[model samples]
Target: MDRRGHGVARHRDLSRTHYRNGVALSHETGSHETGSHETGSHDTSPQALTSVLAASAAGARAFARTTSEERSGMLHAIAAALDAHAEELVPLARAETHLPEPRLQGELKRTSFQARLIGDRLRQGLLADVRIDHADPGWPMGPRPDIRRTAVPLGPVLVFAAGNFPFAFSVAGGDSVSALAAGCPVVVKAHPGHPRLSRRTAEVVAAALREAGAPEGVFALIEGVASGVAAVQDPRVRAVAFTGSLRGGRHLFDLACARDEPIPFYGELGSTNPVVITPSAWRSRAEEVARGLAASFTLGSGQFCTKPGIVLVPDASALIAALPPVHSGPMLTPGLTDGFRKSLDELSGTPGVEVALVGEPLEEGVPAPVVLRTTAATVLAAPRVLELECFGPSTLLVEYAREDEVYEVVGALRGQLTATVQAGPDDDELALALVPLLAEHAGRVLWNDWPTGVTVSDAQQHGGPYPASTAPATTSVGTAAVARFLRPVAFQNLPDAALPAELRDGASGPRLVDGHLKTPS
Candidate 1:
C-alpha cells in the first residue's frame, strides 16, 4: 500500500549478528549489529558500551555549550532526518506494535513535528528566561541584586522509552529531544516491544548528530532491563524521563531517589483519566457526552495514558445508549492483547459490575473493546474498582445520583494526569465547582474537551500528582519538559571572565554568568 506517495512496506527481517557474549541482535540499516537482551540486562563487551556512552556524553557537553542558534539548527536536522526515514520506521513500528499503518504514520509526523517545534522554541530562547531586576527604593536595605532565571543542562539523562508510542516516545522522541535541547546528553533504554525500530531511529539520530557536528556522548541507545537499572543508577546520569506502568516508573523513581546524590525522575505513569458529567449536563446533552466519551475511550484502542478509563455520570442509561458498538481491533502487541483479555475477565466476574458492551473474543492476538457499568455508590464504596487502569479499549461508567456524591468521588480520586468535565452552557455552577477540584486532583484540568490528544505546545501540561506522575509540576510533552533535567545554581560574586560563556556579556549577546544574567564585552 502507498500512503501519500510513500510506499508502505512491511518490516523485512535482517540477519542476526552474534556478539562475543553469544547474545544475538539485528541491524536495521546495515550488516553491522550489536547484542542486548530484552530483560534490560546483557553480557555485552564493555568496550562497545563504553564507546557508545562516551559518544553520547560528548554530544551532550557539546550541546550544553552550544548557542541557542546551534541547538535550533541541530533540531532542524533531526526533523529532516526523521522525515527521510519515516517509510522504514513506520512499517517496522507497525509490525512490532500491531498498530495500523495509518496510526503509525500519523505518529511519525507528530514526532517529527514535535522536534521541529522544539527547535522553534529553542531559536526563540524559550529556556533562557532572561529577567533583569533593578534596585528599588522600597527595599528595606541596599539595592537588590539583579535576578534572572534560565534553564541549564542537568547533564546526562536516562530516558525509558514507552511501549505504546515507540516512535513518539522512543529513542529520538520528545523526551530525548527536550533533554538534548536543554543541553543534556541522553541514554535511551529502548522499549522491548520495538527494539529494532528503536535501533533504527537511534541510527537516524546519530547520523543527524554527525552531520550537524554534535559532540559525542550526546546520545546512546541501550537495550535490556538490567542496563536500564544500571543506567539510572549511574552517577553520570543526572536525570530521568520515563513513560510506562506505575510499577515500572515508581521503581525507577525510587532508585533515583535512593542514589547517593539523588536526581529527579520525571515519569508519566498510567492514568485512569476520569471525566465527570454533571446531572444537568447529562440531561441537556447526554447523546453528545456519550459519543465524545466513546471516541476518547477507544482512540488508539484505549492505549493512551490520557484515555478516559472511568466516566462519572448521573444517568447510566443515557451513557449506555450513547456508546458505540464494541468492535475487536488489533492491540499494540500480542502480550498487551492477552493482558487486556485477562483483565476484562477478572473485572467482569466482579460482584457489582456488569458488562455494558461485550464482543466475542477474537484469535489469541486480537483485543475486543468492552465497556463496563456500575452504580456510583457501588464504585465509591469500592474504590478499588476505580484504581485499575484498563489499558485497552474499555471504559467503566459510574452512575452518580447527586452533585455532592460526584464531588465526593472526584475528591477521592488519586493523582491523575488529566480530569475532564463535560458540561453544557446551563451547567455553570457544576462546572465552576468542579474546575478547582479537578485541578487539585490532576496535573491538568479540561473543560468540554477530551484529554487523549496532547499538544506539544508551551501551555500543554502532561504530568500529574502521584499515580499520574511521580512529579506533578513537571511535564513530559512540552517545552517545560526540559526543566526535568535542569537545576539552578546561585552565584554570589565572580569575575566576568570566570563566568560561563552563556553568562558572559559580549557583543554576541547577553549571557549567563556565575548563575546571574549579564552582558559581557
Candidate 2:
C-alpha cells in the first residue's frame, strides 16, 4: 500500500460521490495502493441507476426530436475533441493495454474518423431511409392513402466497450458513436481493462457533445459489471450495442431477451476469420500470403476479434516454414492470457491436430504465438475444436486435396465476421464458386485482403451470423450500424402538418418514392 491512496484511481470515474466514498473507505480501512481493480466497484444504488436511465430516456427524447443537422454538429464536435485529446489519450491507452504508441495513435485516429464519418452521413440524412408514396385517386386497390415512412431513434442505448480496441472500441468506439448518431442517448459501460482511459475518453466525449448543445445524458459513462448488467436490464434502454467475445456478448443478449419488454441486442461476437489459399495461388505468391497472414494474426498480439484463427491451405509445409518466430507482446489482460493458454492446450491435445510451429516462450502476461496443422477431414470431424476462435496469435492450418473439400470446410463454418480466399488469376472459376459459399457464411468476404483492418466506411460490414454477431442483418461498424438504434415508423394518410421532416417531400436524403429510387432534391 502506498501513501497516495488507492482512491486516486477510483476518482478517475465520472462518479464523484463514489470517488469520495471510496477514498474515505480506503483511509478508514488503512489501505494505501489497492488499485482501481479493487476499489473501482461502482455499485451505484438502484435509485441512482434508475435516475441515470431516466436521464438517458430524457436525453433520447431530446436527441430524437433534434434535427439531423443538430446531431451532425455534435458528432463533428466529438470528432474534433477526440483529435484535440489524442496526445493525452494515446499514452494512457498504451500504458493500460501494452499496445505500441503508433498503433494506438492510428486507432484513436480511426475512432475520430468513424465519428466524423457518421456526422457526414447524418448531414446527408441517409440513415433516415425515408420513403414516400403520394395517394393515387385511380389506384388499383381503389383510392390509396398517402404513406410515408422513415426510421426513428430507438431511445436510450447501452454500449459495451471492448477491451482489445482501447480507442476505437472503447468509450468513443463505433457502437457508441453509431448509437449517438442514430439519436439514441449512449451510456457506455467502461471496459475495466482500460478504466482510466475509458473514463478520460468519456470525459472528452461528454464535453464535446455538451459543447455542441447536446442535452444532458446524451452521453454518459458508467463502470463495473453490475452497472452494465443493470443498464441492460433497465426498461428505458430500448436497444444495446456490444462488441466482445461470444460468452460475454451472449450473456448480455440473454439478459436483454429475458426482459419483460425485450430489446434488440446487436452483439459483435467471436470469429475464426478463415483464409483459404488455392494451390495455384500459393505457388504464385506463397511468401506474400505467408507474410500477410503472419502480420494479420500477430497484429496487436492477436487481440483483434478478426485475427485469422484458421487458415485452410492446400499445403501447410511452405506456410509453416514461412511462419515467423512466436514472439509477441503482452495481451490486453491477465485473464485473456490464461484463456489463450487454455485454448492452445485444447488444440494441442486434440487428436487430429498437429503442432507445426511452436513459438518461443515468453514471460507471463505475454503469449507465444502457435500454429497448428490439420486436414479438411480432421476439421469436418472435429469442427468444434478446430473452428472455435482461440482469440490469440495462433492459427490452425488445414490442408485440402480438392476445391470441393474447401467447400466442405466452409460449409462447416458457423457465421463469421470475414472469410478470405486467395485465388490465383487462373483460379477464377474456383473463386467464383467459392465466393458465393463464403458469402453465405460470412458478412464480409475478401478476395485478397486480410480482415484484420476493418475500414470505417459506407461499405464496411463488421458483423456476421451466429457467433460472429447475434444480428447478422445488422452491422456494428460503418454507416449501416446506425440502423441498429433506429426503427422504422410509417405515417399513413397523415396530414401535411404531422409529417416528419425527413419523410416530407423533397427531403435531403435518398428515398424510395412509389417503389422507385429518388435522390434527395
Candidate 3:
C-alpha cells in the first residue's frame, strides 16, 4: 500500500473462507509474500486492493471537510438507510455469525442507534469548545488571555471490525460513527469470518454517503489480514480503532509504535469482565444474582467481549445453593467452542479448582455454558488460571473467605472494560469505595446492572486501561468515542479566508463567537 493520502495503493490476493473446529473449509493456492515494497503476487490482485484503499482514504478526507451540520444529516440518513436494509443485512449476519435472528436484529438496531447518536451529538456540537481560566485581579499582569480547547480531526482512521457484533462493530458501528463525528475519514478492515455481511453493510453506508452528498472516500472496506496490516502501517493512516483479541491488537499496536513516527492505536482488547457480589447483596439476592449471572454468561453464546468470565462470591455455600445448572447455546464459531472445552478440561484438572457445573459440548458449532468454582487462594496461587480468557459460554466462579480477600483479588485484576457490583441499599459505602478501585482497574463501573447492555449515551465509558484497551481515557461507545479520531490545532490569529471553511466566521462554517463555538445563525 502506498502512503500518498489515497487509500492503501497496493492490493494483494484476498478471498473469504469458513473455518470449523480450527480447520479451513476449503483450500486455494497462492504464494505468500512478505515485505514493505512487494506487490501484485496475491490472488485478489494488487491494483484492486490499491483502488479500495485509495477510495477509502478519499472518503475519509471528504468526511473530514464536511460541515458539522452536513455530517449530522449524513448520520441520520445512514441510520435510515440501515433500517431500510435490515431485511437484507439481518439474515446475512445471522447466517455468518450463527447467532439467532432476534439477537442479530437487536445488534443491527444498536448499530443504527450508534449512528443516530453521533448525528445528535454533531447537531449539539458537544466537542466544539471547552474553556479554562486563571484570572486574578491582584496579579501584576493587566489581563489574562482565555485558555480554550476544542477538538479537531486526527486524519484517516483504520478500524478493525470484530468477528462478533458483525453489525454493531462493523462498517457503520461505533468506531465508524465516532470517527466520522470527529471529522476523520474511516477505512474499515472487514473481519474475514463475516465478509459477505460486512460487504453488504459497507454498501449501505456508501449509498447513504452518496445520497447525502457526502464524500465518496469517507468510508471504505477491505478484506484480508495483510491488507489490514498495510493500512495500519501506512503513513496516511493517523490512528486505529480495533475490537478483538489481545494478541491481534498488541501486534497492531507494536507495528504502529515501531514506525519512525508512531501514531496512536486505540484497541479494545480481550477482557475477563469480572463481577463482584458483596456479602450483603449476595445474602439478600443470591438466587437473583445467580440467575442473572447465568443469563449473562450464556447470552449470545458468551461471544460478547463484555461477557463475565469471572465471578467473585464470598460464600461458597450460598453461591452453590443459589446457582443453577450450566446452560448455553451455540457459540459463534466451532473452533472457539472446541477451544473452550479444551481449556475447561485443562483447568478442571488443575489441583485446586473444582467443577461446579459441567455440560457436554454440542456437535461442532454448538457450545454448552460451563460454570467452574474455585477459591480465591487457589486462583491467586495459580495465576496462570487467571491469565487465559475462555472465549465461549463459560465462566469461573471464585469464592472468597473474607471481604478483605475480595478486595485483594479485585486489586490483582488487570485492566477491564467493566467491573460490576451487585450491591444492596445498605452497601453504599462499599459501593463507593469499590467504584474508585474499579475505575482504576476498568473503563466502566456498574451498579445493579449487567455490563452486556451497554448504552450509547453521552455519559457512557466503554474502554479501560492496558489489556482492556490501549487508551484508558478514551471510550469505544457513546459520543466521546469520536475524540479518539481527533487531534487539536490552534489557529493563532489566522485570517478568515486563510481558515478552513469549518472554522471560518461567516454566514457559512463553524466558529467560536463570544466563547461559544457554533454554526453561524
Candidate 4:
C-alpha cells in the first residue's frame, strides 16, 4: 500500500509484525488492539474494530466520571509526555512528512501547549454551561419548577488525523484534546501521509494517560481509510471529527449521517478564505497589501485551510506588480501535490483568467508559486468555473470597478472560515458596510490583517458554514471546541442527590441562578 494507507491491502493481515522504517501499521490484536493477529491474516476486521470501539465505549463512561481536577491532570500529563518525547518524535515526523525540523519542532511545541491550555480552561469550568432556576410561583412566564441544566460528554469520538499538520492536527491535536477535556474517550484514525508519526504519537499519549490513572481505553489509534469509514458507521462511535479536503470530509460526513444512529460529524474542510482590498487601502499601501497577500497565500506552500485563495481589488495590475516573488516549495504529500497541480491547471485554463506571475521553475514533485488575475465580471459570469480553490502556492486576483460589484461578489461566496478587509481611514464607510456582509458569509472577519494564523483562545472561531466546516455552529479550535463533544441535559424537579455536582444548590463555578449570573464563593 502507499504510505497514506490507501489502495494497498498486502499489509492488512500483518496485525502482529513489528513495524520498521516508518511503514504503514494496521490495527492489530495486542494492547490497545495494536498487536498482530495470530493467523496473521486479520485486516482491521469488523471484530477487531468492535473490540476497540467497545473498549472506548466503556472508557467513555469511566472518563465521564472523572473529576475536573483529574481530567486536568491527565491533559497536563499528555502535554508533558509529548514534550518529553519531542526529540524522538520530531525526527520521525520529519522523515514521514518531509517538513523541516524547525517547523516540526514548533508544531510539536504548539500541540503540547494546546493540550495544557485546554486543561487549564477545563478547570476554569468553561466546558460546563450550567443553569439553575429555583421554584418561582410569581415568575413572569409561569410557575417555574426547580430546574437545572449542564453539558455532558457525548461518548467515544473518532478523530481523523490530518495529513498536512502531522503534529498540530494529528493524533493528540485540538480535536482529541478538546474531546478528552470534555470527558469523552477518543479513537484517532491515523492518516496515511504520516503513519509512523501517528503510531509513535499515539504510544506517547496512551502511556501518558495510563500514568495519569486515566481509563485504559480513553485513547487509541487505528489506521486505513476503510477502518475510518467503518468506525464512523460503528454505533459505539458517538461522534466524528476531521480536517481535510472537501471531497473526503463530505464522504465521511455522509457516512456518519447514514448510520443507524446518526451522530454529529465535525469536519473542518478547506476554505478559499476570500480577501478584499478597498480602493482607498489599495491606493495608500498598495505594496504592503501586495506583499502580505503573497506571503499569506503561499504560507506552508499554500496548504493551509485558511489560505486566501481569492483577493478582490479595484485594480489588479499594481498589486500584481508590487507583490514579492516566492520560490518553489515542497508540499506535505504526493497526493496533495497532484491535487494542487490539477486545480492550478483548471484555474489557469479558464477562458478569462490571465496569468500574472509564475515563480522560479523547480524540478518535478516541487511546485512553484502562481498568481492569476481576472475581472470581476468574468468571475460573476462564471462563478462555478472561476471561484474554485487551487490548493497550492497560488492565488487569484479579481478586479472590481464599483463598490456594488464588491457586494455582489461577496454575496456570490459560500461560507468561509475567514474573510479579510484591507481598508484605509478614508474608506471607513466602505469597511463599515462590508463588515456585516462579510460576517454573514464567513465565521471570522479580519481588518487590515491576514487569516493564515489561527489563534487558540476563548474567542477564537475556527469554523464556518457549509464547505468551511460540517458543523458551522461549532469550532474545532479554542476552549469552546470542547462544547462540540458535549450535549446539554436538563433535570426538572430531580432531587439534589440525583443532580450532578455542578447543578446542585450552593455548588461552585460560574452558573446562572434564577436568571442571574453567579460565581462560586
Give, for candidate 3, the lowest lDDT window spanning 10 residues: 1-10
- For model 4, how does the per-residue alpha-carbon lDDT over 151-188 read when each residue is reduced to its tens digit? 88999999988877888889999999999998999998
The order by descending lDDT is: 4, 2, 1, 3
Please list all clashing residue pairs in model 2, or write none if there are none: none
Q: Estimate, for each residue in 1-521, the C-alpha lDDT of model 2 and write its tens digit.
A: 11111011222222322322111101112111223332344434445566667778877777888898899999899899999998999989888777789989999989999999999989887777888889988889799888898888999998888878888887898998998888899888777677678777888888888789988778777665556788899899999888776766788899999999999999887888888888777878888888888888888778888888889898888789976565677776665676787778888788888888867545564678888888899888888964567777888899998888988888889999999988878546777788889999999999878989899889889888898889999988899988898898899998777888887665667888898998845
Task: Estimate every model's Cα lDDT from 0 to 1.
Answer: 0.73, 0.79, 0.72, 0.82
Q: Which is the better candidate, 1 or 4, if ranked by lDDT?
A: 4
Best by TM-score: 4
Compute the lDDT for candidate 2. 0.79
Candidate 2 lDDT score at position 410: 89
| Residue 96 of model 1, lDDT score | 71
In model 2, state the lDDT of residue 300: 76
Number of colliding residue pairs in each model? 27, 0, 13, 5
Runs off by more than 4 Å, candidate 2: 1-45, 324-326, 361-365
- The list of candidate 1 runs beyond 4 A from truth reads 1-51, 58-60, 134-139, 143-149, 360-365, 501-521
Candidate 3 lDDT by residue in tens digits, 112-136: 9889888987876665653323334
All candidates in order of TM-score, best leading: 4, 2, 1, 3
- TM-score between candidate 3 and the true structure: 0.85
